[model samples]
Target: MADGETPIFPALGAMAPDFDMPASRGRQVSLASMRGRPFILYFYPKANTPGCTTEACGFQEALAALGGTGIPVIGVSRDPMKAIESFADKQGLDFPLASDVTGAVTESYGVWGEKRLYGRTYMGIERATFLIDAEGRLVRAWRNVKVPGHVAEVMQAARAAA
Candidate 1:
């Protein structure tokens, strides 16, 4: 979905694509390790940018509430490991930030796609979020997400699913 193709994320109730990727703070996250626990996978266009910063901080602020409810969250972007590290440190983000440098994960999630800015068409990752149940099936998805109050919405749905 990165070049003029229609965006299509994994269907609800379908198994999420498995992945083992490097994360910030010298950590690694894999779908296999996440079995039997619900988690959030959010994709953003870049690291340390305005929108991304707001979104990441929003998640950081809500982590306490989400953690008590047993839902973990991971932020993903096509940035290099260094960038993610810097961003997390600057933003005080306590959650994992996965680097999808190859764009494989973004493509599988259908969040990487064409975009137009200033009348110039280009490829980028769409701001999207996927809520995966403990069974590894996606229960909900928010494509082209608007940052304001998005994490609250996710928390509400996650509480219900959990």
Candidate 2:
């Protein structure tokens, strides 16, 4: 989970919570609206940073292939819509980069919490991802993720679920 705390929910096969939040592209995405389509929901700490950028770009490079199979990847972050838009545009990310400005959505997913850096501690969203199947139940989850190869793994998981 986000602040290194154990996730506040049950494991896979549980119904993911229904949430509607502003996306980087200006539309709202909700679990209820996505019931019949599989999606990968990834939560990141920030936009345009090293790890976050690498993760987003990795998805950008494989978007066509993943979409060709009909699974959508949605990236969420604490940044505002403006920041997400700029990051998506500058990186040519074709996927939806959702915005969780209030961090409510992040907390709902158990991806927000207390984090410490250099002995300093604060609350922030933890970098994580969830693979929600067509039924809106989680098929897989990755917490406190490292960017490299994460996209490819999510793609594989999505394909398997599909």
Candidate 3:
């Protein structure tokens, strides 16, 4: 890898980067706490935005099925706690939503990068999802995600991982 080059997203079977961040449920969460259980860690750009909301609701809808299989789901973004709390309430999302305010977690996971909107380029998080197995190895990654049918796909993978 060249200088300044971000490592490519962690491949299948790679160990997930550990993170300890403030989650919306009023406590800190870390990858170590999730050990021995498969979970999905999804990153989005912001709270309450159209696409972000859609993706969040999709996960909420799938929570029952995902939980039934003993797989947990977590959503992460750079949004502050207050904003994340409001978004979760407004969207009726029951999963823990972590605030990666400093971008360390996002950067370590390689989802923070350049993005373009209306030809204006800037740094932001790329919507991505990662599935980590019971032992904390990343079993799947979905980057540059499209909202439609995404939760279903993730659920499929989670089911298989179990």
Candidate number achieving the greatest TM-score relative to the actual structure:
3
Candidates 1 and 3, the one with greater lDDT: 3
- The TM-scores of all predictions, comma-separated, are 0.94, 0.90, 0.95
- What is the C-alpha lDDT profile of model 2 across 54-128, one tens digit per residue? 989888888888877788888899898999899989988877888888877888888888999999999987889
Instruction: Choose the strongest candidate by lDDT.
Output: 3
**Cα TM-score of candidate 3:** 0.95
> What is the C-alpha lDDT profile of model 1 across 1-162, one tens digit per residue?
478864377788899988889998999998898999999999999999999999999999889989898999999999999999999999888899999999999999988889999999999999999999888898899988999889889989888877
State how far residue 5 of model 1 sits from its true place (Å): 12
Among all windows of 10 consecutive residues in model 2, the one with the lowest summed lDDT is 1-10
How does model 1 score by TM-score? 0.94
Could you give the candidate ranking by TM-score, starting with the highest?
3, 1, 2
Ranked by lDDT, top first: 3, 1, 2
Instruction: Write out the backbone clash pairs for model 2.
Output: 2-126
**lDDT tens readout by residue for model 3, 76-132:** 999999999999989888899999999999999999999999999999999999999
**Model 3 alpha-carbon drift over 4 Å, by segment:** 2-6
